[model samples]
Target: MVLKIALIGAGLIGREHAKLISSNPRVQLEAVADISEAGKVLADEYGTRYFFDVREMLDATKPDGVIIALPNAFHAEAAMACIERGIPSLVEKPVADTLEAAMQLTEAVERKGVPVLVGHQRRHSPDIAKARQLMNEGALGRLVAVNAMWLTDKPTNYFDAAWRRQPGGGPLLINLIHDIDCLRFICGEIESVMAFSSNEVRSFEVEDTASISVKFTNGALGTLLMSDTAVSPYNWDTAAGQALYFPHQPENTYVFAGTKASLALPLMDFWRHENENSHWQHPLLRQHITLDGSRAYENQLHHFLDVIEGKAEPIVSVRDGMLTLATILAITKAGKEGRIINVADMLG
Candidate 1:
């Protein structure tokens, strides 16, 4: 039984999802909506119908599922539209720009009782899944601090795209939201946040770098460092006008510290040991875990279909999206105000 899928937005990530869904034997790319010529090109490449307006596509194709891969600011409107029509949708991350918007989108999903999953692809990584399983099984002992770093440089052409340089469209919102979701997925719910953010590079309207500390409800503290102005060997040259490649940084890395052990995820590498004793040992793990290099996005799509078919529960729930956004905003507020901020209160 092939699930007819409608893709709303044909941007970089949208094309990636389209490739995965079209390749799946259990899924069929039925229709796509994007105002850009790139969207039409992607639809044609996947042998699917294309529409310039998403609402029109939703009405015409009436697909079993929809992938809302529009920009961060547009997520809420697109997702609310899907759930209101009783169509299951998997939206790309940050869910929405603000907590209020996120709550609205989530509430629609709840009132309509439709399967709407946020795209936090890291939850689907084989290594990430295994790490979470191990952690759950007490391999990591008590969960402690989660330190995540995202550093890179973008080309001037990156801001050439209109929306990316606008307010609410910065590294903290546009990119770190994925890291924020991953931290929430692995560590725990954030209780409060303290942040410091500034535009140190590109002289754009949006912030380019940030340093945030989080207090999780589980009593675990986390620090996230995000910047779009670091040039390193591991960098994949993601600057706009460059060759298209992976959606994330080539040298993706994450560190999770617990009472018993600590783990590191650097690109395809995963490392863990007993406490801080072996911190410097066993540096090299492997090249990459097998089984579909795009597992994160693929699994996100698969899980959405499962919920629509009543076969499984959502991987990332609506509450998760709301809490994560609240945490992020709390961080931004703290950074701007130069003080610690309570995430829960901010959400309320």
Candidate 2:
């Protein structure tokens, strides 16, 4: 049986979700809800009903599941609506604009026993899954250090949106959040964070670049560099070829160093001493781990379908998304205060 899916919001990401849903033979785009004309245009294009109000669409269409891709500010409200109606939902990440709202949404989902997934789609990537497996299997030995980068140059026109230049719309929230989530997914919980951010390049209200230091609960150390004004290919999107808009670059953006070996992400290069000794005196060998190129979004959509059918639990639950958000928010707070922020305390 085809699951009927309703989509909230018609922005770029929302449209992408709609396209994916429509392309899936197991799901049907039953309706769409958005405050703008784009919603109706998208609905008409996809041969689905459209409504300006979420309540009206939920009441009328009675979709089997919902996909919420509204702005960060609206995520909680829309997600709560779906939860209240017992409709399974897949919400785009950061979950909500604030930690408080995300907590409330997760609480409501628990109370209602509704299934909800967060769009940390990277977890669905075959490369990431394999990396996690290898880490768990001690292929990377005792993970000691990690380094990641998300440097890119955005076009001037990309900042034309008023929100894009606002405090919450910079590279930290807009881009770095994904990296934070991936780190947490592959490594473990973040214990604390310290960061320094700057808007010197654009001098906008939002930060254009940031350097972050992280302490993982498992006693691992990590550093991350993020910028929206750099013309480099050291980011997941560019390196992984996940998004078609960016030209794919053959380079790894993350490096994981462990006691036994080190690994470079996306490129899937594993480095270790030719002998098990793993000492400075030994020759290091590089082995490239092959990956089956899979589309994360498509895999995510299929997982959501499994969730709606009660066949599987969410890969990224609401609470997990909140934790990721707390980590990023702590990074932002650390940058602002010029001190380390405890992620656990911030979550509480």
Candidate 3:
């Protein structure tokens, strides 16, 4: 049986989801909802119906599942609507704008006993999944420290939107959140964070650069550097060749150091001592790990279908997404307050 899917919002990411849905033979793009004319245009192009009101579209199409790709602030409300109707949904990342709203949506899903998937597409990447497996298997040997970077030069035209210069609009929230989620997925939960941010480059209300220090619950230390003003190619999206929009630069953007070995991400270059001795006399050997390629968004759609069909559980649940958001928020708070912020305190 083909699953009918309704898409909420017709923005860039929403349209991408619509394209993926249309490409999947097992799913039908039944209807789309958006406040802009793009919704109708996308619907007409895809041979589907369109509505300005989400509720009206949901009622008219009665799709088996929905993909919520609305703005961050509208996530909880639209997701709650679907949960209330027992319609499974795959909500885009950062779950909601605020912690309280995210909690409310999660509670509603629990109370209604409906399935919801959080869209952290990196978890579906084969390289990331393999790294996670190796980490869990102790291949890295008790991870000690990690270093990550998300440095890129976003064109000035990208910030033409008013909100892009506002307080909540910056590389920390817009880009770094993905890396934070991937770190949390591969490493353990972050216990605390301290950070410093600057807007010296663009002088916008949002920061253009940030340096963060994090402590994991499992006694691991991590350092992260992010900048939207840097003209570099040290980001997961570009380095890993995930999307077509960016030029693929095969460089390592993350480093995980452990007692036994150190691993560089995306490149998957493993370094270890050739001998059992931990002395400076031994030379370290480098081993390259290769993984098959797959489109993360397409894999995410398949997982969402499995979740709707009850064949698989959500890879990134509502609670997990909320924690990732809280972690990023904690970093932002730490940068502003010039002190350490506990992840648990933010949740409370």
Q: TM-score of each candidate? A: 0.86, 0.98, 0.97
lDDT of 2 by residue, 56-147 (tens): 89989889999998877788999999998899999988798899998999899888899999998889998788888889999888999999
Show pairs that collide, candidate 2: none
What is the C-alpha lDDT profile of model 1 across 253-288, one tens digit per residue? 666777766666644343455335555654533334
User: lDDT of each prediction vs. the true structure?
Assistant: 0.76, 0.91, 0.90
lDDT of 3 by residue, 107-142 (tens): 887777898899889999887888898899998899
By lDDT, the better pick of 1 and 2 is 2
Clash pairs, candidate 3, are none
Off by over 4 Å in 2: none
Residue 188 displacement (Å), model 3: 0.5
